[model samples]
Target: MSNQDQELLIELQGQIDQLLESHELQDLTSWPTEGELDTLIAVEQGQAFHITLQRDPLPSIPLTVLQSSSVLQIKHMIRLQLEKMEKNKGRHRRISWKYIWRSYCLMFDHTKLSDDNAVVSQLGIKQDSVLRFSRLAHAKGHHRKAWRHR
Candidate 1:
């Protein structure tokens, strides 16, 4: 492996060790139809990954995952899904980038999610909802002087 790749691997292992200390392994009770690997976050590594455990095919049912999970968790899942899809097509994957939700005229208040920690039942996001998150726009407050000068 290249020197950079080796360095990244070491960094990832260190972060994983820290996360493992705080979070418990997911069980069926916590996550029904639990996957072999509890979806995990490696913040320092900027990666999220999981392995399926069930004998059944990986179900794409949003409700199953969203109902018991927090909105923040759903965001992670969406990132994970996108990462998997892009990787399959031979693209790079990283989940650390900022995001801004968009759909028509919908206003997304980042500080106040529809239900940040509530179950999806409370969120009311429809089945097959396709959330569109683009790169977050840079804050506009600081550039007012340039506009006034113009």
Candidate 2:
């Protein structure tokens, strides 16, 4: 490896060592199957997995992310990947992250992942899991009218 790559690797190793020595990982024996610390260790060990993101009219997008990543982080990744795909196709569309979170619900295994702070592993999202996003009915500018009708 080049000198710069070697230096980067050493820096990463130091950070991993620091994290491994942190108080949260002290009780390895008590680590739960879906715990954040376990996911962190898996990420450090290069055990990240690929998940499929699907929405109607668009082909499924395969994304690889660390198991400890939060729903919010995954949303950000999805935005980035979408933008990249658009750019590759000679389009320049900028997706609003805030609007996305406000206007859509991401579902996994028929359950809405309502908590943005929830970790992927904790939500039971595993390798090959299919996450689907759908627009929220209330966010489509019909809530006021629907409420008035009610």
Candidate 3:
């Protein structure tokens, strides 16, 4: 990587650190706290610069880091990732609690509705009847409402 590219990666890592500190979500994972400088590899592939960000024991982030004179490219990349994560979350939220519970029961070889109430409570779901409907709301992309439900 060139000096300019290294500088850009360092800047991006700083921005990520700032974001994590501000969001207070860093405790959710051990990756961020393990290091100050997050080692990111930037590969120039054809016309695009592909950035591979390593996350501990999870998934690798493949981002096409754009080389542009425009000031908005960094902002654009952040926005794009945020939008993509939101969309992915929407898909996962679609998995109904009824389905989740059913699957949980089947997988664990457990039965008894009352004992499952704790799981439902953790999800802030009071009744079994509303599980599917609540998940549908989440699937429809009402994230705020879904969080409220939880």
Judging by lDDT against the true structure, name the best candidate: 2
- Order of candidate numbers by TM-score, starting with the best: 2, 1, 3
- What TM-score does model 3 achieve against the real structure? 0.24
1-150, model 2: which lDDT tens digit per residue?
Answer: 999999999999888777667786763433234544555566557777778999778799877678788998898778877986998799997767776777788999988888989999899998888999966666465574332534
**Candidate 1, clashing residue pairs?**
36-53
Any idea what lDDT model 3 has? 0.37
- Would you estimate the TM-scores of all the predictions? 0.36, 0.60, 0.24
lDDT of each: 0.44, 0.78, 0.37
Best-performing candidate as measured by TM-score = 2
Model 1: per-residue lDDT, tens digit, 1-150? Answer: 999999999999888665555535332233223242432223113333222212124434221243455666766665665676678689886644342343111112232354456654455444344333323343577432332534
lDDT (tens digit, per residue) of candidate 3 on 36-140: 222122112232244443334645444443333122342234345546676867843333534443332211112223242233223332211111101122336
Candidates 1 and 2 compared: the better one by TM-score is 2
